[model samples]
Target chain A: MRDEAVLRHSNIWRPETIEDIQTKAELGRYRIRGFSALRSRVLPSFDDLTFIPCTLTRVPLEGYREKCSTKTVLGTRFAKKPLELDIPIMVTGMSYGALSYNAKVALARAATQAGTSTTTGDGGMLMAERENSRVLIYEVLPSRYGMNVHHLRMANAIELTVGQGAKPGTGGLLLESKVSDEIAAMRDLPAGVDQRSPCRHPDWLGPDDMILKIEELREATDWQVPIFVKMGASRVYDDVTLAAKAGADVVVVDGMEGGTGASPDLLMDHTGIPTLAAVCEARAALEDMGLYGEVQLIIAGGIRSGPDAAKALALGADAVYVGTAALIALNCNKPIYVEDYHKLGTEPYACHHCHTGRCPVGITTQDPELVKRLDIDEGAERVVNFFHAMTLEIQMLARACGKADVHDLEPEDLRALTLEASMITGLPLVGTNVVFAGGPGWKKSTHR
Target chain B: MVRQVECTGKTTREINQEIRRLIGDGEQEIVVLRPQARHNLGVAVLQPVKLVFEGSVGYYCAGMADGPSVEIRGSAGWGVAEGMMSGTVIIEQNAGNSAAASIRGGTVVVRGSASARAGIAMKGGTLIIQGNCGYMTGFMMQKGTIIVCGDAGEALGDSMYEGRIFVGGSIAEFGNDAVIQELTPEDREFLTSTLTQYGITSARPFQKVVAGRRLWRFDKKEFATWREAL
Candidate 1:
């Protein structure tokens, strides 16, 4: 007790996390999303489910050596040069102030090793991460950080964010409880106070101005980078049509289940269209505009595995982006952090506290000490491993489908369960082509 | 990287001619806004350039630059780098609104504060504000990131689709289709790196602001969940 008496007098934890946090359902909180909702609510019923059972005419993709290749090209619609990757999985954009530098580094390094690309979120570009990742997708958002000419010149592609699926129209908040001294400095904001970011752009008032803006970027960067526009699924047809017309090389649509830095529980469970529905609308929009196949479509939000990806592709997505699943691969719920998760009033599986950078496991903090918990090399390797696993799974699915390449999995290969899906996606059902029209045995949604 | 340049000078025709010549001669990188840069009333346009402005710049400095990275040494007049796409523009000093109006891709960083409507209707790209900003920043932005280090005026990020707004200081107000949520692991991880990358190691504990999910429209069950909570 004599030796421990002195140590007991003071706590070593950062002072910011202990105090300064009041209420977080707050409209005045800092920017970003990814938090657990304090209050419980009636969860949305996504109970509509169906199964793709095996039959005499249907066979499953071989899992191991089916010669299934998972490879695809993106952004050739407008850019003279497009990006090529060795694997199917790519890192999605998360932000600075919402994540730690080490996290970014891991993503960059992981993407590099996996031979895929990593995206920069709303927060400015981090040099350490950039140097590691050979291909980087820079995000142009409503809230710009560390933005400049130098970085743009280095970018492979630029994604213009309109909304995300998690909490589509909602602006996110990062609480001061997670704010480390270092994070505060880069952002140039006061320490320990809730920050607010307006949800709108102040420059132009309409689509016409957007056209000019796109022109300016082309002029400035010599048109080296492909400019893709991203939007939350709202008026899917209208939004994608506008984006294509606005000169986007690619259109990314995030479904309702998309992750966030920290969104209201109410919003995440409530907002936006599902990935399947949105894909249909977006596909229709591009087809009508004669830009389909020419303009690539990337779907994100709740994609988990190779099968999910195949399903999305069958529904018409060129590629599917996975965020939460990637985090899981990065050790999001390793059970080792069970105690830490409890400290945040959540569980390991509920590790969505992006609002507060003060993740107990050291994945998202500016504090040098806390950040040390993250072994960058090990983390990067984990990400690479995850990518490899996913690629293998995609290959398995493709081979089972009797295809040599994952890209060969097209919409025509899918069989919808409900008539609504057949009508929306134009795919035939498992054993019958009469999904929406006529078939021997079929079921239609009563709502339709 | 392909580069382009446009000179904003009295002779609009001359500036255009020079830019075209530079491109023709295989000069992929160009800088139009140099320190102490001066120009007459002329409309200039550029494709892309790793351009720099060492000194103060004049009006319409980067009126229609596309896919070029332009840095301005001094403050700019009205409509500086208006309608830029796929390139980056950094201003050492304050800027007029519409600095990155309708920006499709790339980013714009202002070391000093920005006037009103800095990123109006920005479709893509990012706008960084090291200093304070006037009202109506990020108004109707279809997508992109806009970060203000200093205090922001009213109605920021109004009706934004995607992208995010991170600020260190107090926000005067929150805009339409926008609310505040908590930050997650990825967000904190990003903040640590973002601060270190740009010598912004000074500000700790930044807040992340994102667009409200309601804009994408809602389903009946989803709508009920949101309503019941409130």
Candidate 2:
């Protein structure tokens, strides 16, 4: 007979939780990690919603023959030159310090090839990235590392970053292992030091001050490029309104599932709302303020596939920014370097050791030896293929729903597969004509 | 050539545009009148010209300019001459918080007392305060010199990376990772020359504060320092 004590385990004191407690006790500090959160409890996601393709009730376009336009335009409100893209997909800001030189150049090349844009992250713009990119969006993060006015004039667009979704309330963290001499020089910090960026901008404090800040950027750029205000998705409704009111040409909302190079594990899992809910609230806030189409919206965080991008577009995003998914396409966790992954005390496909700065794939490390493993041209080709595939998927879904243009695929074409998703999206449940819960200020329009 | 631009009827954008236009037209010295504490005056003037604000200006006056010498005759608001690449900004009277914040190059001189967070996150350049400054002066300073001719408030040079702060008068408190260092001959010479150039004189010897370098890397043994630094 088996012992009853061995069979009965307390739910609160699971093995993982026990390990975490023991590890913290020994370390005397919170665990720092990389990548997105690893929450066991599932949150409402894009997978919980499915499109209802047109049938006899509605005339469907030929999926194979009909053209579905995916063209997207952003920052048209006050910018003399707005960002126009052939597709709705853009690469999000991943800093040069967080990513290797090869990875940054490859992303830039791929973005240029795909007729979209790539953004510079916390660290200042790399010269090679500028040379490779056709349209580059320079991010002015809180740290202001390597901030130069000459470089600011070279950008096609500017993103004023308040906070990222991974660790909303805190600044960025680069462990000592990643603070190489070159990285240190770029960031103006000492070599081999642990760098923690400040959470607040040095000059501006609140939205009232931000209006002048935006004007300053405009004056610096000669009002040539669009100004985008990016924020972590918490209190999405109020924050979106504030950003729009602050004279932002574009508002980018990064949800809780957003990826990071390094952050405290507790903050990654516990902070910010999910992308599914953030998009809804962001749309409601814009529509409430009567600035829905006038002020372009870009949704980010945990967007992996074409279906996810398509859903974001239908939910009112002018475009979508992909980070971790793009990294995955460049072989972030592929089983090529099993030995290195093992050395980091993890295996491929389950490795979250980016904070250690010994990235097996060379995508997120500063080590010269590891960085040699990634071939820039080859990585760029793979990312371009992935972008093409994702675009095809979005077009296929839009054509199946009788949409000539992908932006025409509205909320009416979607039905929630779960009760929570139904409530979150304000859409009807599958095989039901009634919506159980209308999302915050979500107006229901009659089907045509 | 000297040009006069009035700020009474025009918007901030128009005033800045007029400044740019006059600069482009080879006007070397431009005088701004009405001087009703407007924000963002003479912003991004890349040319090496002179801007004289007849009176007080609001936030971010002469911010992000590459090459320009700006003189404010009256008091100024927050972030005066922030992110300036090259040039000189002289404030005649009491200045608001965060004056000369995150400037990369050039010198910012506040003739009168300044408020909190003066010279915060200074990448390079010199910040001179003729009178007493408020709390957290020279916080997170990376590389530069900050000379305060009078007493400084609490937490001077907090978490500084690689900069030198010289306070002529008493310091309320020192910030984390900040330690008092003996002033070198070079420090004394720089202080004397810079004060004379800015037309300020000091009575007492100055104290130099620098980063302790304890918070540079993480160590399990230095848990006490890490606790506060983190």
Candidate 3:
């Protein structure tokens, strides 16, 4: 018998998995990329739980005619004029430097048409965006790039961004190629310069220092607009509690799956928690502090469909923010221009080269030619359509669950599909009363 | 007639509220008395009124002035005349840190000394400091002209983009990404006119500090040279 030796493929620490080692060897610097977190870790998510519709005990509402309100009131805890949105979904912050001017205008117009709000991201407020948007939330980022008192007053609300879902502890990285003359003018940076926004605000030190800044903002705006504290999902319970104590009317928690203009892949995929776990922890923290209803919670990161929105609502989110999904809705990776994608060294959906300033979809690039490809009117229409579809889906789900209002969704309407989800959400598994962690039969003595 | 008001027993909020009400009533000339070094005096003044403060004021005095012309008769604390949009703010005495920070299309004149980071991040405005300026003056400044008639401290114009800083006296040191450029004929003429307008006629040979432009674009080889400057 001839003995044949077989060489098995190694899965543990695979050396030839895409040959990232070769790329690192060829280039001294690690590859910088963009887009959402692409890690394959199986974490607890909204998909882990399924909603239970109306049956014998519960009564179902009419889907076709009956009115199910999706109205959302935010920043009611402190601000004199809290925001009233016709829909619960709002556009997440995407800076002008990271996106084209036309993209920003499109988002503003679409949000206005959808009867929701849009956010002014890292850079200062663009004139077109401010004029088009009915309710604009101006972001006061750590960089303070375009912070002006007049612009601050122009906003309906102000968001103090400490971190993002993609890179929590790191600052933003804008490549020199993207920092055009126009963008540099807006950001107050040298044209064609690589910019690294500071990770922390230059004026504030810690939570204690945050109190004074919040007061300063309140005084600056005459206590008219709501103060939102946005944090990337890390130490969710503690961060949410601290934000509440710091006098935040709204707290936005972004998970690891959040997208960015440019970031190190290590930071995006490895850091922060999942959106499902973050919302649960945030709600738990608010509930524990007895300020759940007072301070609204908004969740983001990987929110795609209406089912995802409904599940997030049931898990304790007051509203939802869409960034990557919104971009996709605007034809970010629609495979329309194959030649342009080829020139970018990428394809439609697989493109993550936003930092290169060569986006084929015209959503993220600052190049005038590329920007012109995305028509403002068409983009706005797409956004309005996407928002309407999402709203309809959410309303449909709510009516099915016999909920008259979208805010009426609670965890009781949901059941965990897997034991891991049950443990994470503290919900009963399907067709079982036992949670195994802290359910009806949980006992310390028995577990010990 | 000057519409005079007293802030002796009122808080900053009340004083500002009264100011707002007076401005809303179309009062062009207003006088505020007994300021007593209080913070946020004349903040967010949007009207084209003339506001005169009688006594010393605290931090952020005359903040975010749009069309108002404010004259502070006494000294000010930190962040004086910050973010003034379209007005003239005259500080009679010394000002603290971040004086005239991020001013956009306005004029701020400080008669006395200014602390660190004066005119920091100023976009479009003219800041004239008659007295000496502290370290990091005009740090990361974008588009503005800052004239220091007296001596300047360390790191002047550090990481500045396009703004120009004219120092009439000796500079203690230069900041990163900053270089002493030759005083041009246009710069000298602009400086002379700006100073003459501000009633400063001293013939101190001025040195202009502008961006080196080395840090504008990132090159791996050039980062080593400009890293210390930033």
Candidate 4:
């Protein structure tokens, strides 16, 4: 036999791939997991672009001293009352079933304290969540589980969800381990059974029908709150345009990197467009229809820090929604419970066992024992600190770019670090004046 | 008191606002004229009142309403009383697709034939169709009662969780996990009372359809059943 160090691994048929095949062979089904994708290949992300602060051309405000407005207003088109947030960052929708009761309340409390908005997810509004939140966005998902008219009336905004990023064109999945008695009762499902939600809304189908559906929702709320049409970032240009045309006050595009509580590993690894590319397409779509500013755009998926949020805003987004990051702030994968994490067959930072309902730090599990580990007030404080830090980082970048308001940070303030980023965003690469490929404006020019 | 509103030049917004204002101002009965099949009329009317639509109405007429009794003299478009919590909707003529979709509780009576997917995803309510019904009737129905007086098209009661479907005409084909059950005296009594309340009569003996519960939980041994259900 040759020396062990001299042995070369096959690039095509890798060790991990072999293990995956064997696992599936034994299970006789696709593997299920939680969290975002674990793709090994590098995708174009916000990190590919860097902000160009004022050097000699533009005047820079003092980063620490100057006041930069983080105020974000969404849904100026047709809503009587739009969402007014203190910061451009918001807590994305995560269902009560996907997260524990303690986790939901903590997020709501933190959002209220931070003066931002929090959204309800697939399982409908938790009464405690509503009570804890100052500004609540009600989601009208395909499942329609626990949907109530009284709850609809009580919401500040309504989000008509078409799809999500992690698993587009499919319904939500909650594995048997996470489907507790309370969750089952709320969702009208049997306890301890894997819950697969419906992909299509029972009432409507296509965009034309969606127009009527929007009208119905508007009528339901007495046209008092904004109606947001949220979809996974596939066919972003067409989908965004249709959503805007169908009378959406706000359009949310969730990219492929978005997180989920439980999903097929295959779907998590492969589906939808990247958030960076998605924002460009969405902005272009809105601009093509001459409704860019009229209909607000919110971006979600893989937005980790202030730099990412700033880059997204510079690209075109009015606001950014964070899901996994918020959960992280609530101690989702903390290393405190070393033994518990080991028992789940994962390490502290490498844990993606949320689908198993055995979360060590207790943000995503329904088990009472795990849930008790997360103190609601302490978790809320931690998340509030994270939100503050993110908001400060965003403000610092905006001030450095000579923007008085975070929303004023435009694409001109950004420069691509790579050729792929330059091509995707239509931005000039650093130290280069050439635009390598067609960008957001390419579609408009072709149509003309 | 009775109030009449005209839909000649006013927008759907203006019309709905006026209807709500009238309801707020202690009007027990409101009649809408020349609806022109406009969509989203009398939606979200939580007050207990009576609404009379003189002509045909477009999509989602009386949608998301909690408490109201609406009478459409002409035909109705899709989702006639969708998401209604508790109410009564009576359509005089034919209804378009997905009529009474996803209603939690209420009574929807379609006097004439109804199009496809009627009573789809109904949570809890009673849907009475006097004439024929199109395909996929009661599809994914959770908890409700659908009474069809005439022929039922293909794929009836598909993937339903828990519901009762009584068809008075020839069976087309059952959908996945949907099974026919021998009707009991209690089911017959409920159907008779519901149909009679809606002024509907049928000559043919009704066949009851319900969920087989096979799709409720996944079983590895029942691969064929799971394959179709999934």
Candidate 5:
């Protein structure tokens, strides 16, 4: 009704922290809070969702029902072995403090079943996660919650979490409700109280200190793990470049639509660049520095489907990290638990408290009874199936593009309609010079 | 042969190698004559053999112990027993910050009081202090037990959970979620048994404390704006 509302709606730059976003996402009326609408907005994840048919111009390979190579390598730039993940989909970090132990267990099992890596959240290494996951990446956050020096040594990979898309420069809080004996033990916090993780790491002050922290962990672990640094997608190019300079083996950038277990509503709806903008900036930065192939880019936030994975790969992400998607696989919004949603003070799928742990789906809760409702075996199977389907779909699209590998999916195949997107992503507008590769927007090399 | 291993001049790696050799050779106990400052950066990298050091050691003295009884005759340094896996570490003298912090299992006994921030961010296991402890003892500590024979300096057991803190002396303050509770007979029995397990012969009564049970989950209303690091 007002000019401000029109401008806000028309423009991508809301200047709002994610906290203010109200999805108006009705789970049959009890609107889900704390998340940006994944489906809204005019920007298409991709156009035509089309794949160029294999022809004389582009030769398609029949996906080996038997032998077409599908193995993906992660942390290749830093790790000696570089994980040979069976699929491209990754299970993102969901803390043991925020979600039930069984939920974490299911995620690990599911990822393992799908032959992909599962990341451990701030709650440290889960025994189930460690045993189930073939390749396990450990997350190191500001709070040092549940971070054990020994486990750090044992981690297959280590991710230094700088910020989340939903909540940036803010701490992680596991409310009093989720703290069970196990959760408390994992995070080393008392149950039924807010376990707030500091926003800044105690020992690491800035990017420079973060570099040394990387070396310290590498030395401590005898250089066994590939180190990954993740951040909310605010200053994408600068952050990605700095991360690469800081010796990150992989850079994980989570965009605005990224989901969180628990964050202020103001932060969830606002803050950070969109996923499309972020992936483009990070890719350009890496490619400009000749670190594109050398340093892997993993994108997160609001990735929910195979086509989304394809869009990310086309945008130059080596792999995709799925958070909300995996939760969905774990029956996050399954229609069956409409009743459970009400009991937890929200609607099924809309109840993201993953911070509350009272999830009736048995996904997020510390209550022994609620936790018991989740069967790791069953839940894990669902996750595995979801990954399998997404991979198949991605491969199908890749085959349509006449591409043999995921890396072949290029930005030339993509188109962006919004001026805000062009500015935010730092990407060359398709067939236009408003933006160019190694674009005019490329930040000056301050590090070199 | 006294088999007296003098660590006073040896590096951590060299001293630890000797400790491993003796323990691996079936020596139930071994004596470490002395140690230089900062003696054990990764002293017992993973060996759980019982050990005794005659003199003071420095930072991370007993860090990451898989299973071992590492005892120092003199005071110890910062981050003692950082994330120690199992077994026991004893300090006959005082200790610096973060004593027995983040231990997954086992026990750490300090005959004297611990310095400031003792057991900060501790995970599991038992910490026994024969004397008083410094400020913010057990800060952000979760799932374990801490016993103090003397008064807590300030803000004892800040942000503690699940585990119990039994202090014979007065506590200056308590952290969020941490509250003093009546020591039940079961608690007394457990404390007594736990003390016996560590051979802690103390006469004062122990007070039991615990973290209130609650959890924060992701949902619509609360923490809607609290940003999370992706």
Candidate 6:
């Protein structure tokens, strides 16, 4: 008696699920794709949090006249010179090999203009990036690709990347097509060969060994630069605590929605927690050890706008890092490259073919022809504009919350729209007195 | 007169600054005295100068040397001559693990024995070790030549790609995806010229090692054929 049209398909074996299973059976392999955690899941995020703006009890700062400072400092605990920024936003680590040289240059130039730091990702420091970036964070990953002591000294900070959010338990992949001569040279791999970076550092097996490694690196750098430990958002509480105990000046947490150049589609969708949950865990871990503000926390992954950045800060993150958003601001998937997009078997706004090394907009490719499509000046200007816009939005939010400084905004300034968000962030539910048990109200829990 | 910098009580930063200052002033000949195992000597120096270290050095000695010539009279610690773009680093004594790692283009001559993972990930560089090399020499090497005058330890060349290794002495082991290939005329010439340049006279036959050509490419259709076979 049921209508056939109403009962389209069962949830267990949906059409796409069936197609994926059939494809796996035929190819005898899992799907490989770019971008991270794109599966349709209603994960609680900043969107589920609404700011409690100042009212009669507190006076709100005027948007134009009031002086609200966005200046932020990181690595104060153990670094001789901590990173000072005009804004709390930073450019996350994106390797030169994964991104075109032009794109790297643009990012460096833009970050410099914004008075914020840009990070040197997996494949070491590019000459152009070093020359253009006023402040640069050098990442030392498991692969040790293009790593050298000289470059280590050249950095403002050293980010020891234990894992990435996209593929926490897995390594990275630079397929053969993307392995151009320059990329190959930088990574010390053969031209036209797939490069697989290791999942864990060769020198360190656990936190005990990591402590020694951190000391070694610190001594090598003359204790001038800060040491940051970046971990994927799995076991954030334990990992952050260990990193802090190991003398890390800063801890960076990347969530599931972080982008990658190339990763198995299965891993992207299945691994790691969301950015919303990650910040809360990291903060709780730091606070438990009485090292929350002493060791700055920077969170990334799916940070799209000013609101997202503000939300992260409210959840106890000192700063926020952006990657995909910065790339998009530089015109990653604009309508002009529709023809190139079609050639890559994708289109604007839905493109995830960064692994192909044939990026339509020239952001992720090493191909010279496609690389030239992005003008460095225009791209840098656009990135600067994006940072400005995002910072403006953050200041507005902070002002409306009646905070003179961006860092003054606390968890009390926010309320979760959903119970899930309230539980994750430990913030109070909107229009409710209930302080959820796994959240900030539970004094016995480490989250308090 | 050669510009001299002493590292007796000075920190690495002071020594580095003095070296940079001397190099910036176009001092071609520099002498470092009382190194006392100080690390990062002559690091990232791009000038075409000659630097002579009086004593043993620590980790990353002469790293990222672009065009300078660095001579270490004594032993060195880990990662010596790492990522040298172009230049010459002569270690007259022994070297620790990961020597000449990821070197792009340069000539690194280790007169004494080398520990594990020597010449790891070397790209377009030449590493000549007069003595034995420990396990995993030339591990994951790419587009370079590594020559050992003495015996090679376990995993002679593991997972290498497009690089050539010449072991003048007996080999103990070979790692995954690494196999011994017949010494070709080109390889013989390269080995001979490299050995002669480093003043290494060896009567033992040299065996060539290269990637097994199994992991050169990955085919989705032939997944098991490649992954499992390797």
Best by lDDT: 4
Q: Could you list the iRMS of every candidate?
A: 10.7, 5.2, 7.2, 6.0, 8.2, 6.4
- Candidate ordering by DockQ (highest first): 2, 4, 3, 6, 5, 1
TM-score of candidate 3 versus the correct structure, residues matched by position: 0.85
Measured against the native two-chain assembly using Cα atoms, what DockQ does each of the candidate structures obtain, in the order listed?
0.09, 0.45, 0.21, 0.38, 0.16, 0.21
Best of the candidates, TM-score: 2
Candidate 5 C-alpha lDDT tens digits along A1-448 = 5587555433454533232234233111222233353434444344423344556876676865523345777777756656678777898888876677788889988888888888888777887778888878989887677777667766788899998876777777566566677776566554555566767554335787577556555545655578899998888888998999999999999888888766655566556767877787788788768897889889887888888888788777888999888877877767675776665556764556465566777776778898787889999999888888898888877776677776677755544444554554444564564643343233432223
Better of 3 and 6 by lDDT: 6
State how far residue A139 of model 5 sits from its true place (Å): 4.4
- Candidate 5 docking classification: incorrect
Number of colliding residue pairs in each model: 144, 0, 2, 0, 62, 1
Q: What is chain B's TM-score across the candidates, in the order shown?
A: 0.76, 0.94, 0.94, 0.94, 0.85, 0.94
- lDDT, residue B186, model 1: 85
User: Using DockQ as the measure, which candidate wins?
Assistant: 2
What lDDT tens digits, residue by residue, belong to model 2 across residues A148-199?
Answer: 8888999999999999888897899888888889988887788878888888
Model 2 C-alpha lDDT versus the unseen true structure: 0.89
Compute each candidate's TM-score over C-alphas: 0.66, 0.96, 0.85, 0.95, 0.71, 0.84
Error (Å) of candidate 1 at residue B81 is 3.4
Root mean square deviation (Cα) for candidate 3: 5.1
> Which docking class does model 4 fall in?
acceptable
Pairs in steric clash, model 6: A426-A439
The CA lDDT at A111 in model 3 is 97
Instruction: Pick the winner on lDDT between candidates 1 and 2.
Output: 2
DockQ of 4: 0.38
The best-first sequence of candidates by lDDT reads 4, 2, 6, 3, 5, 1
Alpha-carbon lDDT of model 3: 0.84
- Model 6 / residue B51 / CA error / Å: 6.0
